[model samples]
Target: MTALSIYQQHDRLLVAVDCIIFGFDGQQLKALLIKRSFEPEINKWSLMGGFVQQDESVDAAAVRVLQQLTGLENIYMEQLGCYGEVDRDPAGRVVSIPYFALIKIDEHEEELLEKFNAKWYALDKVPKLIFDHNRMMNQAIERLQLKASTQPIGFELLPEKFTLTQLQNLYEAIFESSFDKRNFTRKINSLGILQKLDEKEKVSSRKGAFYYLFDRDKYNKLQHEIKKFI
Candidate 1:
């Protein structure tokens, strides 16, 4: 058989991309979910997703899906994995590549969310999702926890400047566990990748916590010296 003839022998499968977007709301980690508009499971909660277009790469498709719902670009996203179980999607023979994204909760465009009938649910409180999305979410959470421990990626979900208390809160939200305030602060201080400012966040207390910015330059240099953040 000719190479072209041999290539035509196999069955065709659809390729799709799903985005598992995580955000921090100062207390808990949340994921953005949309009400599916198409049938097979119309109106059901699902991860933001779409079929990969003929002209676009999987990465571009994921970015388009995320931006359609969040109205933001230049997001911090990473591929979680691929799901190709035969019956994972009752709709058809579709393979989905899921990407996990971290976004600052306060920065997303509210109008875009309203347009898509989307909602943000705390990770622990997320409702059952369509198809194998729950499985994808569980895996994304595991991957995020691993990434957060080894890299300073968590800063992507926080404001440009935040208090130590807020920083600890973000870590606790990601890990779903509490840390000793003093110890957490000490550990973060020891890293020397934070630039402390005179400005303080007084809304939380009478004696407010000073704000600090993540020093990306310092973090880049510190990466070679240290292996983990928590």
Candidate 2:
């Protein structure tokens, strides 16, 4: 049989990409969710997703879905896993590739979120999601925790300039555990990837905390080295 003839005998399947967009507001880890607009499970909370087009790769489809919902581009993203269970989707036989992205919450477009009726839900308090989305989200969170342990990927969720306290809070929220302030500060300082700025953030207290910026160049140079901070 020819290439086209052999492929024609196989069944056609619908492929899709689902995104678990994570954000850190300096206090809590949040996931962006949307209430389903159309049927099968109408009006239920779901991750942002879309059908993959014939011309686009899976990564491209994920980026497109994220951009459509958040109005942001080139954010940090990674493939979580594939969900191909036979009865995962009620509407049809669909194979979904799940992706997780970390974005600065303050940088996303508020208008797009409002347009899509999407809201940020704290990781610990997210509602029941439709289909296998809950499993996808749980797995995504696990992957994020693992990624953060080895790399400074968590910085993607924070602002360009932030206090060390904000960074510690983000890690605590992600791991859902408390870290001793002194130990956490010392561990972060040992990383040597943060540049202490002369400016101080006076909003929180009379004795303001010094602002620090993540040095991307230094981090890049040390990318091959394994660094762990918990």
Candidate 3:
């Protein structure tokens, strides 16, 4: 029998990938969500997702879904986990692979987002998501927290240059707690992965805070090194 024929006796189920796109807009941590356009839960808030095609891997499918909604490519994404409860999807038996992506909020294309009815919702203010998405989001957040503590992945959410306050705010938003200013600054300085620029961000205040950029060279060299920020 052919390979396809050999699996004829086995059950066939749809495989889907759901993306939890996280963004930090200087002040708050947000998630990209879309209002479902098709049944079985039309008009409800949901994570952007699509069924995997025969020719594509789940990773490719996840990237496609993220690109379709945000018109972005080469984003920082990671597979959160798999959700395979037999009846998780009401329309059919769909096994879902969830991914969490960190993106700069200001970098997404507005037109593409509008096309998908996509909007950024603060983590605390997000509406009830369809399917097992709420669970998926919670898991993603936990994973993000763990990853941010050890990795510099959180830098993906900020702009190319940011102030120390903005960086501190991003962490506070992620962990839902405030940090002591002195200690937080000291910890970040200890990493030595940021390059302080002469220019300042004047938008937040008249005096403005000096801008700092992530030193990719230093970061790459220190990838194996772990530092605790939380």
CA lDDT scores, all candidates in order:
0.94, 0.94, 0.93
lDDT of 1: 0.94
What TM-score number comes out for model 2? 0.98
C-alpha lDDT of residue 17 in model 1: 97
Q: What residue pairs are clashing in model 3? A: none
lDDT of candidate 1 over 1-230, digit per residue (tens)? 79999889989999999999999989889999999888989999999999999999999999999899888999999998899998888879999999999999998999999998999999878999999999999999999999999899999999999999899999998898999999999999999999999999999999998999999999898898878898
For all predicted structures, in order, the TM-scores are 0.98, 0.98, 0.96
Sort the predicted structures by TM-score, highest score first: 2, 1, 3
Model 3 earns a TM-score of 0.96
Candidate 1 Cα errors over 4 Å, as ranges = none
Residue-wise C-alpha lDDT for candidate 2, range 102-215, written one tens digit per residue: 999999999999999999999989999999999999999999999999888989998999998999999999899999999999988887789999999999999999999999
- lDDT tens digits by residue: candidate 3, 61-168: 999988888889999999987899999999999999999999999988999888989999999999999989999999999999999988888899998888999999
